[model samples]
Structure formats: C-alpha cells, structure tokens
Target: MIVVERTFTVTATPGAVLGYLQDFANAQEWDPSARRTSRVGSGPIAPGAHWRHIRKMWGVTTELTYTLIAAEPDRLIFHGRSESATCTDLVVLHPVPGGTEVTYRMELELHGLAQLATPLLRGEFEKLATGGVTAVTAALDDLSRPAGLRRRLGAATPNRLPTPAEETGI
Candidate 1:
C-alpha cells in the first residue's frame, strides 16, 4: 500500500470546501491524472453517490468506480476500485480564522502482481499527489472569490409571478 497526504488552507468556508469536494466528478478539475469523471446517478450528492473515473498515469489508462463511503460536516471518505487496485481517499476540513484548513489523503493498494511494483511507483505517485494538491488549492481559491454581478444577482433574486405583459402576448 502507498499513501500520500497533504494539508493546506484556503480562504473558503469549511462548508463551501466540503460542498465542492463532495461531488466526486469535480476530481477531474483538480486531479492531473484524471481524464474524465462523471457521476453514475444524479439526485443529490450523498454517501451513496458514485462516480466513474478514467485516469491515465504513465501512459496507461485505468477506469475506476468511486463511491462516497462516508460524509460528515467536516470530513468525507471515498472508496474507489479498479481491476488492479483499490483506492481510499479521505478529506478533512477545519474552520480557521479566515478560511478553512483541508487535509487530503489517498491510499492505494495494489492487487496480485501489481503489488510488486509499489515501491518503484512511489516517487511518481508522490509527484502526482503534489500536482493534485496545487490544483485543488487553486480551485478552492477560485471558489472563494466573489461571483460576477450577474451571477450574484441571479442567485439573490427570488422567483416571482411573470409581469402582466407576459400573461398576454401583445
């Protein structure tokens, strides 16, 4: 088994960070090795939510089905399985004075003959982990920025009955 962990702080609330990370499909946005990721079914992002992820590393592509195994106000856990490997990812969030501190950890366990190469692959995996951490930090920083005027107004506005002109095409 190989594990990599990173901790970083961002100027986003813990709720905002957890909300963003809970959607596994967002991995594609921050994971350098991810080629594609899509949710299996869509309703709400909860513990049972799953995502199909295609990742390419060292020129070899692998597909994994990742399930949200656990979720809490300050933490999330995901389990991913592929033909040759199983991965567990844990994310923890803590509120800071001005933002949130996040800790991300990933553990990979190889099966069968693949385990033989685990030691040799550690360096490369470490590089990927570093890149992923940088990407995630950037993503969260962007998330903390205020939205554009239109977007802010859109979200603030409440739905109301259409104007009288819309009731009759004049």
Candidate 2:
C-alpha cells in the first residue's frame, strides 16, 4: 500500500470550502491529474454518490469508479476501485484564522498484475500525490482573488448579476 497526505490553508471559510470540495465532479476543474469526471447518477449527493473519473498519471490515463463512502460538513471520504487498484481518499476541513485548513490523504493498494510493477508505479504515484493538493490550492487562490483584480488582470469576466434589461431581453 502507498499513502500520501497534504495539508494547506485557503482563504475560504470551512463551510464554503467543504461545499465546493464535496462536489467530486469539480475535480476535473481543479485537479491536474484528473482529466474528466462525470456524475454517475442523479439525485443529491450523499454517502453513496458515485462518479466516474478519468485521471492521467505516469503518462497513462485510466478510469475509476468512485463511491462516496462518508460525507459530512467538514469531512468526506471516497473509495475508488478499478481492475488492478483500490484508492481510498479522505478530506478533512478545519476552521482557521482567515480561511479553512484542508487535509487530504489518499491510500492506494495494488492487486493482481499491478502488484508486480509496484516499484515503478510508486514513484509515479508519488509525483501525482505530491502535486494534487497544490493544484487545489492554486484553484482556490484564483477563486478567492478579488473580482476587480481578476477583471483587471484579464483572467476573469466581471462576476455580477445580469442587468434587468438583459434579464428582460430588452
């Protein structure tokens, strides 16, 4: 088994940060290793929420089915399984001075033929694990930046409610 962990603080309240992170589909938007993610079924997310994720690491892209094994306002856990590997992911959030402190960890277990290449795989997996949380931190930084600064930097469009005229198609 291989395990990786990371912790960081972001400029968002715990409630807000957990709300965003709980949407596993957002992994595609914020996680560099995640190439795509799609919800598997309709309904509110709960302990059984499922998602299909396509992730690339070590120059190989693979698909996995992830099930939300646990969910809470400040914690979330997911179990992902593929033909040759199982991954357990845990996320914990804590309130902090200016934002939330997030702890993310993942454990990977290899099986069958994959076990034979564990040495090579561990090295690559370490790379992915090391960089994963940093990707999330970068995303939060972008999201937490002031709107005016984002617009002036030409990185984002103005975030505002639509004008009444536009809303009314005038």
Candidate 3:
C-alpha cells in the first residue's frame, strides 16, 4: 500500500472550504486528474452517497465509483474502486487562526500486474500526488484572493482573485 497526503492553508473558512469540497460536481474545478464527476445518488452527500468520476492517468482514461463511507461538516472519507486498484481518500478541514487547513490523503492498493510494478508505480504515484497537492494549493490560493485584484490584473494578475479551477490547473 502507498499513501500520500498534503495540506494547505487558505484564507477561506472551514465552512467555505468544506462547502466547495463537498460538491462532487466541483471536482473538475480543482482536481486536475478528474475529467468529470457525476452524482449517482439522490440528495445531499453523506454516508452511503455514491458518485462516479472519470480520471485521466498515464494517457489513459479510467472510470471509478466512490462511496462516501463517513462524512462530517468538515471532514469526508470515501473509498474508490476500479478494475486494477482500490483506494481511500480522506479530506479534512480544520479551522486555524487566520483561516482553514485543508488536507487530502489517499491510500492505494494495487493488484495483479500493478503490484508487480509497485516500485516504478510508486515513483509515478509520488509525482502525481505532489502535482495534485501543488494544484490544490494553487486553487485555494486563488479562491482566497480578492476579486477586484483578479479583475484588474487579468492574465498577468499575481495572486489576485483566482477560481479554484484556475489555481489547480484543472
């Protein structure tokens, strides 16, 4: 098994961060690996709620289904399964002195041929995980900026208002 975790501090409140993270549809706006997300269950997300997402990896596309196993106002835990692997993602939001601390962690288990290539695969996973963390950090930074600055600076804008999508390069 391999695990990767990253955290970022954002000016947004925990509530705000949780609100954005809880919206499965918004995954495209922040998670670069996600091509699209579709809800599979009715009503608001909670334990037992399910969703499907198509992700791109290694120039190939794969679809996975995730079931929410646990959920709190500021934390979410889910497991995802695909033909080759299974993984758990934990998202946590904590209130801090100035804002919120958002953390994302993933634990993965590879099977069959994937397990045979664990060493090489782990390196790739690390690169992907690091890239993901960087993207999340960028997204949060953008979301926390001022709107006026974003509009005024346009493409050249430095740290002005940034949409989660723009920040994460999703």
Candidate 4:
C-alpha cells in the first residue's frame, strides 16, 4: 500500500473547486496521466456515480472503474478498482482568505505479485501525485478567471483574476 497526500491553495471558492472535482470524468482536463475519462452512466453527479478512467504510466496503459463513494459540499471521496490494484482518492476543500485550500489524498493497494514491487514504485507514485496536484491547481485557477483575461493569458493557461478586495483596495 502506498499513500500520497498533497495540499495546495487555489484562487477559487470551495464550492467552485468541489463542483469542478465532483465529476470524475473531468480528470482528463487536469491529469497528465489520464488518456481518457468518461462517465459510465450519467444523470446527476452524486454518490454512486461511476466513471471509466484510462491512464498511461511508464508506457503502460491501464483502465480503472471509479465509483463515487461520498459527496459533500466541501469534500469528495472516490474508490477505483483495476485488475492489479485498488485506489482511493479523497479531496477536501476549505475556505481561505484569498480563495480555497485543497487537500488531495490518494492510496493505492497492489494485489498478487505486484505488491512485491511496492517499494520500487513508491518514488514514481510520489512524482505522479505531485504533478497531478499541480495540474489540478492550475486548471482551477485558470477556470476561475473571466473569459477576456483567460484569452489574454493564453489558451492553455488562463489568468487568475484578483479578488474584489484587491480591486477596491479595501
């Protein structure tokens, strides 16, 4: 079993962060490892929703079925399963002065013969987890900006707008 937890702050409200993350299919937008992610059966996004996520790592592609295990205004928990491993992802959001603070935790449990390689794979997993969190923060910060600012910043990375206090010098 390997676990990676990271915390970052974004220029968006807790509600905005949660709304963007609640839909697991959106992983493709922020996760560099994700080849594709899609909702298995779509209606409302809530507990019990499912997503099919395909990710490529170290030149090997793997597919996992992820289920939404818990949902709240400020937190979300998901469980994923594949042939060789099981994964749990937990995301928590907190209100902050400028925006929101996000804590993301991921746990991976390898089965069968793969468990033996856990030590060797720990470093790689840590790298991926750090990169994933950075990407998520970038995506959310970009999405929080207005269209005009986003366009000027760049199509790839939108600019984050200043808060009302900053604008009024309050």
Better by TM-score, candidate 3 or 1 = 1
Q: What TM-score does candidate 2 get on C-alpha atoms?
A: 0.80
> For residues 1-170, what per-residue lDDT tens digits would candidate 3 score against the true structure?
88888887887777767766675555555566777676674786778877777778778787778788987878988888888789899999889998889888989887787777667767777787777766656655566678664322112312122344765999
Candidates sorted by TM-score, descending order?
Answer: 1, 4, 2, 3
TM-score per candidate, in order? 0.86, 0.80, 0.76, 0.85
Q: Which candidate gets the maximum lDDT versus the true structure?
A: 1
Taking the tens digit of each residue's C-alpha lDDT, what string does model 4 give over 1-170? Answer: 99989999999888889888998877877777887777876589899998878889888898888999999988899999999899999998999998999999999998998789899778888998888888788878876798677522212421222344765999
lDDT of 2 by residue, 1-170 (tens): 88878889998777767776776876776566777677777788788988888788768887888899998888999999999889999999988898889999989898998888878877776777666667677666555667665422112322222444766999
Q: Report the number of backbone clashes for model 4.
A: 0
TM-score of 1: 0.86
Q: Please list the Cα RMSD from the true structure of every candidate, rounded to 1 decimal place.
A: 10.8, 9.0, 8.3, 12.2
Candidate 1 at residue 104, lDDT?
A: 95
Backbone clash pairs for candidate 2 read none
Instruction: Provide the global lDDT of candidate 4 against the true structure.
Output: 0.83
Better of 3 and 4 by lDDT: 4
